[model samples]
Target: MPRASRLAAQLQDEYQAEVSLEKGRGGVFDVWLNDQLVFSKHSVSRFPEDGEIQSAVNAHLAAN
Candidate 1:
């Protein structure tokens, strides 16, 4: 997914957090923060909007 790559890049730049994308069954899109699932596209059936993914990750980071 193009957004996955873009999100990975954005996260690296914005948070300095290393992100790795792995293949899952079908075209499921899952966003994880520290091994915790943040966004599950398979269940939601939609890709996150611009800045949404980063914000979610940042929120989690800020809380920790």
Candidate 2:
């Protein structure tokens, strides 16, 4: 939960993005941007490293 909060803060601060956190079961953790899936812990079987999700969001923002 703390990690999620930090990630939200980082995204909001860095990209001016509106972030929302949804409760999930079974260790689910994902990051989405603009309705696109940026990162998924379930798929990767691990959490994102520090700025991984941020980088993904940045790339998505730049592309679109």
Candidate 3:
């Protein structure tokens, strides 16, 4: 599955505008912020402080 479909619901729960992932030729999971389509291979898989995936979800919400 692509990051967009997987993360869209999570992003929606926290009131993010919109997000989608673009798979590069190398098959990296890039994180996109809004339709402007910024790319990152950082694999936003963990943020340990808050102890729940929703916390990490909310942090990204606050970010954008």
lDDT of each: 0.83, 0.88, 0.48
Give the C-alpha lDDT of model 2.
0.88
lDDT of 1 by residue, 1-64 (tens): 6778888898889878878998777878889988788888887788788887878787888888
Off by over 4 Å in 1: none
Give model 2's clash tally: 0
The digit string of per-residue lDDT tens for model 3 on 5-29 reads 6566665666554544445575454
Model 3 error, position 49 (Å): 13
Question: What ordering of candidates by lDDT runs from best to worst?
Answer: 2, 1, 3
Winning model by TM-score: 2
Best prediction by lDDT: 2
Give the Å shift of residue 49 in candidate 1: 0.8
Model 3: runs farther than 4 Å from truth?
34-64
Q: Kindly indicate the candidate among 1 and 3 with the higher lDDT.
A: 1
Q: Model 2, residue 57: displacement in angstroms?
A: 0.6
